[model samples]
Target chain A: MPEPVLELDRLVVRYGSFTALHGLSARFAGGALGLLGPNGAGKSSLLRCILGLVRPAAGTVRVAGRDARRARSEVRRRIGYMPERDSFVPGMSGVRALAHLAEVCGFRPDDAMLRAHDVLHFVGLGEERYREVAGYSVGMRQRWKLAAALVHDPDILFLDEPTNGLDPRGRARMLTVIDRVRREHGLHLILASHLLPDVERLCDEVWVLDRGRLKMADSLERLTAAARGAKRVRTRPEAAAALAAAARAAGLVVADGAAEAELVLTRPEAEVAPAEVFALAASCGAPVLGVRPAARSLEDAFLEALEGD
Target chain B: MAFRATEYERFTGRRARRPVWWPVCTATLRRGWSSRWVRLLSFGALAVAFGFTALFYFAYQVMPNWPTLLRVLGEDEGMASGFPVQFYAGLLHVFVYPILLPLSLLFGHDLVARDLTSNALETYFSRPVSPAAYVLGRTLAYTGFLLLTTLGPMLWIWAFDAATGPQGRFGEIAFVPLALIQGLVPVALVLALFIQAVSSVTRSGVWTNLAVIVLFFFGFVAGQILYEESDRPEVVSVPAASGGRNEAEPAAAAATTPAQAPVPAEETADNGPEPTVPADAPPRIRPDRLPLALLVGAALALVGGDPTPLLLAAPTLLFSGDRQDGRPPAAASAAVGRRGPPAGAGRSADRRPAPASPEERIVVHHDPRLLAVSITEVIRGWCLGCLDRSYPEEVRRAQAGRRHRFRATEPRQVPVDLARNVLLGLGGLSLLLLFARLRRQGTVG
Candidate 1:
C-alpha cells in the first residue's frame, strides 16, 4: 500500500502553560482530507505542524512518511501551503514573490522563475507580473497567494481556510481553483475549514476535531450514517399509522410527526437505503407516500459527537 | 500517441509566460522599507545634521578670525592648526562634529530591528532566502539611506563654504570624506552592529531598537565616566564640579600625548565668541585649544573605519576623535596577539602576510567550546538528532572567527558596561525561547 501522506501520533503543542493541542493523534491516507473544526479547535495548528512550521511538543508528525519536524525542508519541498492570513510580500509584483518562494523551495532560480510564471498564469495572474502585491484586491491577493503555494507544484497542498475573508464571488473562485488543484493534479489536499458545506462539497474523508482532540476521523459517508437522524416521509393522513407500524416492525425508530411521517433508520448507510422503506410499506398494505433518502449531515454529526449524544 | 502528442504541443503553445520574482523581491523590499520607524529615524538624522550646522555656524560667527575659532574648538593657539584653511575646512574631523549624535544613536537603531517589530521578518524569511543573504542585502539598502540623510547637510556646509567663505578651496572638500571616515563611520558601525545584534536576538523590533537606545545611551554615559576616570584617576575621590569641565580632561583627549607641548596664545577676548560654543570654553583658550583639537583631526580622519568591535581590533586600525568618551576612534583594531583586557580595546599586533592565504583575511578568535554550544543549538533547532549519522568530524568543525567570549571584564565593578553584555545575553535567550515555542506549535514551519 502507498504510505499515508500525513501521520500524527499523540501530538501536543503548548504556549507557556496553556495547551493548544492536547494529545491529538491522527493518520491520514493520501486523498482529500477535510479537517473540520470550530475556531480555536486546533485545525490550523494541526496544518502548521504538518507544514513543519509548528513543532509538536510531544509525539511525532510525519509527512509522506518522513518526520515533518525533523526533515522540515524536505517535507516543505513536497508540500504547498496557503495561509489564512493576508500577509504578502508587499511592493513586489505577483510573479516575483512566487518565483523567489519557488527558489527557496530548492528550485534553481531560473527554473523557479519559469515555474512561478506558469503557476501565476495558471491562477490567472499573468498580467500582474510587475504590479506590487500591496495593491491586490482581497480576491486578487488570495489568488496571488494561491499562485505562490502552487508555484512549486507540491505533492500535498495544505490549505488553511482558503475561502476565508473572500467575497462570495471570490470565495467561489477560490473554491474552483482549489477544486481544480485537487482534481486535475491528484494532489493530496488537507483543507481546514469551519464551513461544513465546503467539506461536504470537496472532501472524500472528514476529520472532525474539537478542543484539540480528534472527535472522529472517517469517510464522510460513514460519519453521516453514524449520526443519521430519523428518516422523514411525506404522506396523506390514512397511511401514516400503517407506515409507522411497519417501520416499527422493521425495527426502525418510528416517529409520526404532526406534519409528516418518518422512520429513523438505526442501521448505518451500508445496511440499507431509505428507499427500502417503500417496499416494506407496500408489502404491508400501507397507503403509499413519497419516500426520501436519509439526512445525516456533517454538521449534525459534528454537534452530536461534540455534545456526546 | 500522435493525437496525444498533438494535444501536448497545443497545450505548450497556449501557455503564457513572463519573468518571475517581479512580485516577490519587489514586494519584499517595499514592505521591508515602508516602515514608520525608518521614516522617523531618517527625519531624526536630518534634524541632527541641522542642529549641528546651526550650532557650528553660531560658533563660527562669534569667533570670526581663525585664531578665535581655533580656541572655541578647544586647541592650543600656538600649535600649528594644520592650516587656517585646514582648521576651518575640517570642522567635522574634530570630536564635536554633531553628526554622531543622530546617526549612531538614532538612525542606525532601525535598520534590521524594524523588520522584527513590524512583524515583517517572519513574512520575509518564509520565502526561500537564507538568513545571511537577507541581512547583507537589507543592510546595504539601509546604510545607503543613512549615508544620504547624514551626508546631505555636510555637503550643504561644504557648498556654502566654497561659494562664500575664506577657507574656500577645492582641497577643503577632501576633509569631508575624511571626516566621514573618522568621526562618522565608527559610530555608524557601532549603531548598525548593535541594531543587528539586538534584532537577531529579539523577535520584536521595538524591543531591539529600545535595546539599542539603552545600550548607546549607557555607552555614552559610561564613556563619560570612563573618560573622567582615565584623565584624573585622582578625580575619582573628588566629586565632579557641576556647570562644565575642560575638554582636555576628556578620556579621548587624555589618550593622546601633548603634541609640540601646549602652545600658548591669548584667549579670544573679542566679539562675544561663537554663541554655540560650549557654555564653558573659558572664551580664551578656546582659540588655542582649537589647533590642538585640530591636530589629531587629520590623523583621526585617516584611521577610523568600521566600529564593529572585532573590526576595530585589527592591527593598525583607524582612530576616532571620540568626544563622548570610551575608546579612541581610530584604526586601532584589537588584533592583540591573543592578549587579555581588550574586549573592545580593538588593538591588534602588527602582523602582515607575505601572501594572502585561505584564512588570511579571516580573524579566527578561536573558541571551539562556544562554537560547540551554538552548533548544538542549531542542530537541535533543526531536529537533526533523529538522524544520528552526521557529517564527518572535520567537516563539522565551525569557522574559528565566530565564537563567543563570555568572559567580560569588571562588569560588576562597572555596572554600566556589564549592562549591555547582560542585555545581549537576555535578548539572545528570549529569541531562542520564542523560536523553540514557535517550532513546537508549527507556525514557523
Candidate 2:
C-alpha cells in the first residue's frame, strides 16, 4: 500500500491559553478532502498545523510520511498552501511575484518563470499578469494567490477559504480551475471552506471539525447516502401543494424539493417507491412529469455532522 | 493577429535547493532598483565622488606651495608624498552622512514593514524558508546596495585620484583599501540590522522613514546640547590670549594627555586685551538649527571643494532642524561651525584659554562621536584606529606620519566605546527579536 499523503497522530495546536486544535488525528492517503467547519472551528488551525506553520503542542503532523516539525523545509516544499487571508508580495506584478515564489520553492529560474506563466494562465489571470498585484481587484488577487500556490506544483494543496472574498461568478471560476487541477494533476487536496456546494462539487471525502475537535470523518458517498433512497416528485406548480399533502396522508414522509414545483417523498421503513409517488400525484390531480431518486445536499450532511457530536 | 495558446502544462523540470534566500535577495534588489528615485540617488552619489576627485586634483595643482605650507606648520606630513588620512576621514564623513544614510532610508524603509502591513509574510513563510533566512536575505539586500553606493564610489575615487595624481600615489595609501573595509562593513551591518528591526515594527514605509529620521535627529540634538552644557574644556582656538603658549602647549598636550586643564571665561580678559565686540554682530546659528543640506554644503565649502558638487550632495541631506530657541547668538564662534574645527578641537585634554574674551577667539568644538548620532563617526574612528592596530610596525609609523594632521591621540575612549558596544548589542538584539517575532507570528497565526 502507498503511504498516506498526510498523517496526523494526536496533533494538538494552541495559541497562548486558547487551544485551536485538540488531538487531531487522521490519515489522508490521497484524494480531495473537504474540511467543513463554522468560524473558529479549527479548520484553518488544522491546515496551518499540517503545513508546519504552527508547531503542534503535542503529538506530530506528518506530510508525505515525514515529520512536519523536523523536516519543515522538506514538508513545506512538498505542500502548497493558500492562506485564508489576502497575501501577496507588495509592489510585484502578478506573474513576477508568482515566479519569485516558485523560485523560492526551489524551482530553477527559467522553469519557475515558465511555471508562473502557465499557472497564471490556468487561473485566468494571463491578461492581468503584468499588472501589480497591489492594484488587482479582489477577485483578481484571489486568483493571483491561487496561481502563487500552484506555481511550484506541489504534491498536496491546502487551500484555506479559497473562495472567501470572491463574488459568485468569481467563485465558480475559481472552483472550476481548482477542479481541473485536481482532476488533471491528481494532486491531493485539503480544501477548507464554508461553502458546502463548492465542497460537494470538488471533494470526494470530508472531515467535519467543530470547536477544535473532529466531529466526523467519512467519505462523501457514505455520509449523503442516507437520503438517496428518497424519491423526488416533480408536478405542475398549481398542484405541488396537493401532491405533498396527499403523500403525507398516505403515511409517507413528504418535504419540499429545492424548486417550487417539486415535492420530495420518503418512507422511514422501506425504499420510497416511484409508483407510490406517482399514485399520490395522480390522486391529487397533478400532472406528474418525473419521479426520480433524490440526493441529499451536503449541507444536510455537514450540519448533521456538526450536531451529531 | 493569430491567437496564441495559453495552457497549463506540467513542469517536468527538476527542482533543487540553491539556497532559498537567493530568490528573496534578488527580488528585493530588483524591487529597490526599479524605483526611479533610488536609481537617481545612486548615480548622483557616484557623480559627486567624481566631482570631488576632480576638485581635489585641481586644488593640488593650483596651489603647489600648499603642501610645503602644511609641512612647515606641522599640520600634515604626507601631503607632499601622498593623500593625508584626514582627507580620507573627511570624505568618509561626507559619504556616511550625506550619501549612504539617505539612500538606505529610501531603499529599505519598506523592506519588512510593508510585508507585515500587507500580510505578505504568509506567502514568503509558506515557502521552504525560515524567518532567519528571510531576514538574512533582506539585510544582505540592504547592505549590498549600501556597499554599491558608498564603498564602490569611494574606491573609484581613490583609483581615479591615484591615476590622475603624481606617480606612486597608490603605494603611498596602500593601507586605505583595508581601512575602508574595516570601516564600512561594520557600519553597513549595524545600519542594515537597525533598519530591518525598525522596519519590522513599523506598518508603513512613511512611518519607518519618519521614525528613523526623528530618532537620529533627536539623538544628534541631545548630543549637541550635552556637549554645549558640559563644563569640559574641549574647544581649542588657533590664536589665544597667552601669546600662542596656550595654543601650542594644550594642542600638543591634548594629543597624548587624558586629563584636561580647564580655563575659566573671566581669566581671558586679564591675560589679553579684550577684543571689542560689535553689538550688532549676527548671532552664531547652532548647526542643529540649520537644515542638514546647508551644513553639508558648508562643510564642503570649508574643505575648499568646488561648489558644483554641492548641487548633487545638498538636496539629499534634507533634515530640517527645529530652531524655536530664542537664545541670543554669542560672539567669535560662528566661523568655528562654518569651517573645520581648529586643531585639537573635540579633545577635552586642553584648556581653551577662555577663548580670548569670547569675542576675539574662534571657539571651535565638535565631538565627532556626537555628529549625526548615526554611528558614522564611530565607524570612521574605528577605521583609523584599525589601521593603527592592525598594521605592522613600519606601516604603523607610516600611518602615524599620515595621521599627524588630525592628531588623534587616543581615538578610542572608554565611554564612547561603551556606547558603541551598547548600540551594537542593541542592534543585534533587535534583529534576533525580529526573527523570533516573525516566526512566532507565522506559527501562531
Candidate 1 structure lDDT: 0.49
On residues A176-237, what C-alpha lDDT tens digit does candidate 2 reach at each position? 88888888878889999988888899999999999999998988887776577788888888
Candidate 1 chain A, run of 10 with poorest lDDT: A256-265
Q: Residue A217 in candidate 2 has what lDDT?
A: 90
Best by TM-score: 2
lDDT per residue for candidate 2 within B1-445, as digits (tens), equals 1113255556787887689888999998998898888899999898988898887588678874453455455533333222345456567777888888888888888888878866778888878988878988888888988988998888887777666655555665566667777767777777887777777767578888999899777765765564443212333112322222232221222333212122222311123322232323333323222234544554554354345544554544432211124222221222222222222222334335332344443434333323324344344545444433333344435544443323221322212232345346545555654665576555665
For residues A1-309, write the lDDT of model 1, one tens digit per residue: 988998889999875566778998788988899998889888988886666555578989988899886676567767777777766643356777676666555566666666666776667667776787767877787787777677776788888888877888878777887887788768889999998888888888988888888888889877776436445566566677777777667766654443555444455444445567667777777755665545667887777677862
Q: Estimate each model's TM-score.
A: 0.55, 0.73
For residues B269-312, could you state the per-residue lDDT of candidate 1 as single tens digits? Answer: 11222111121111111111222232233234224321332223
Best by DockQ: 2
True-contact fraction in model 2 equals: 0.79
Pairs with backbone N, CA or C atoms under 3 Å apart (clashes), candidate 2: none
